[model samples]
Target: MTTRPGRGRPKASDGADRRTALVDAARRLFAERGFAATSVRAVAREAGVDAALVSHYFGDKQGLLVATMALPVDPAARIREVLDGGRDGLGERLVRTFTETWDPHEDVIAALLRTAMTGDPEQAPALQLARAVLVVGVREQLQGPDADGRAALVAAQVVGLAVTRYVARLPHVRDLTPGDLARVYGPAVQALVDGN
Candidate 1:
C-alpha cells in the first residue's frame, strides 16, 4: 500500500529552519553576552532547539563564534597554515599570514579589537578568545620551559602590531606594504618564537 503525505510539519525544511534559528540565536547571544559567556545550551534554548544541534551545526563554541562574527578567515586553519612548513621561518610566515588575512577585513578586526580592549564584562570573552587563538597557536609550535611566556610575548607583538597598524593607524606602521611589514616585523616575532 502507498502512504500519503500528511500536513503537519515539513521534514525537509526542518533542518534548514533549525540551522537558521540556531545561527540567529547565536548571533544575538554572542553580541549580547559575548563569546565566552554564551554557552551552547543557552544558544540552543534561545533557538528553541536541542543543545546537541549546536554541536552538530558548529562543531564547537569557536566554530559558532566564527559564524556569528562572520570572520573573513578561520584563525585555527590559518595558524596551521602558517605553522605547516618547518619552524625555519615561522615568524615571517605567521606575520605574513596574519597581515594578509586581516588586511581585507580591517573594519571587522578593528571592531573586535575594540570590544576586546573595552574591559566590559560582556566582552571579556572576546578577549579570551583572541588570547586563546594567538597564545595557543604559538605555544603549540614552541618547545621549552618558558613556552607560555614566549607565547604571551608573541601574542603581544601580534596584537600590538594590529592595534598600531590597523586600529590606531600609526603613520609608519600604516604605511608599510605587507612585504615590508613582514620583513621588518618577522624577526621580532621570530625572536619571541625562539625565546631569545
Candidate 2:
C-alpha cells in the first residue's frame, strides 16, 4: 500500500485562514491582557502559528492593533476624504464621516470603548490606536496657533458624541438620524476646527 499525504499541518492555501486566526488571537489577547502586555510571541502561540508569521502578516504589534480593531473604514483615507474639500466644512464632514463609519460597527466600537474605559495599563495600546486615528487626522488638518489643543478639543467632541450615542446609548442622542446629528453637532465641531 502506498503511503498517503500526511495530515501534519495546514497547507499554504490556508494563508487567509491563518491571518484571520492571528487577528482573532490578537483581539482576544488585547482584550484579556491589554495591548501593552500582550507580546507578539504570545499572540503567535495563541494562534498556533510561528512568530514569524505574525511579523509576515502584521509587520508588528501596532499593525496587529489596527487589524484587531477591525475599523469599518481606513482612517487615513477617510481623513484625506474629509480634508480634500478644504476646511470650509471640515467639522460637518468629520462628524458625518465618523458617525457613518462607526454606525454599522456599534457593537465593536462599544466593546473597544468599554475596554478602554477600564483604566488598565494594558489598554493603553487600544487607546493609542483610537487616538492616532481620530486625533492625528484632526491635527494634520488644522492650522494656526495651538493646533494640538484644537485637535484635542475636536477629538474630545467627536469621541464624546460617539460615547453618548453608541456606548452610553443615550436615548435622545441615539434617536437622531445621522443627518440630524451632522446638523446638530457639526457647528460645535466646526467652531473647534476653525479655532473660534
Candidate 3:
C-alpha cells in the first residue's frame, strides 16, 4: 500500500477555509463592536471554529488583523516604484501619491479609523496590519545598518499624515489645497525619509 505525502500530521483543507471565515467574521465584528470589545473567543464562535483554531491560524489577534486587511495593493512593488524613482522631492511625491490613492476610497479607511480611535483591542489588527505592510515595503529603501529605524520613522510620518489629513479630518489641515499640503506637510515627511 502507498501513502500520500505527509510532513507530519494530516493537513486539513479546512485550515485555510477556517482562517478566511475567521477573518471575514472578525472584520464584520470589528466594524460592529469597534475592535476593543470584540474577543477571539467571540470571533471563533462566529466563525464556528474552536477557539484554539483562532490562535493556531493567527498566532494572536494582531496577526489576524494584519492578515485580514492585507493591503489592497502590492505594497512592496509600489514602494520600490516610489523609491527607485529617485529620492529628490520624494516627500511631496509620496504625500501626493499616497493621499491620492487612499482618498478616492473613503469608506475603508474611515471604517478603520473609527475602529482604531475607539481604542479597542480588536482594532489592533487593522492598525498593526497597516503598519506591518508599510514597514515591510519601505525597508529595502533604507541605507546603512540603522536602516530599520529610518524606515520606521518614515513609515510613521507617512501613516500619521494619512491619519491626520484623511482619517481624522483635522479641520484646517483638511481644507488645505494639495499645493498647500505639499508645502506644509512635505518637509516633515521628507525629514522622516531623509533621516536627518
TM-score of each: 0.61, 0.61, 0.53
**Judged by lDDT relative to the true structure, which candidate is superior, 2 or 3?**
2
RMSD of model 1 against the true structure: 9.2
Model 3: per-residue Cα lDDT over 1-196, one tens digit each: 2232434443664244667878888877765565667898898888776777777888988777666555465444555566666667777777766666666544355557665676555644656665676676566655666678877887778767767776678897678767777777888877766767
Task: Between candidates 2 and 3, name the one with more favorable TM-score.
Answer: 2
- Per-candidate alpha-carbon RMSD to the true structure: 9.2, 7.0, 10.3
Q: State how far residue 104 of model 3 sits from its true place (Å).
A: 1.1
What stretches of model 3 exceed 4 Å from their correct place?
A: 1-77, 116-130, 144-146
* Residue-level lDDT tens digits of model 2 in 133-172: 7687678878899999999998899789988987778997
- Using lDDT as the measure, the top candidate is 2
Q: Best to worst by TM-score, what's the order?
A: 1, 2, 3
lDDT of each: 0.75, 0.77, 0.68
Query: In every candidate, how many clashes are there?
Result: 0, 0, 3
**Candidate with more favorable, higher lDDT: 1 or 3:** 1
Arrange candidates by lDDT, descending: 2, 1, 3
**Distance from true location, Cα of 3 in model 2, Å:** 39
Q: Which is the better candidate, 1 or 3, if ranked by TM-score?
A: 1
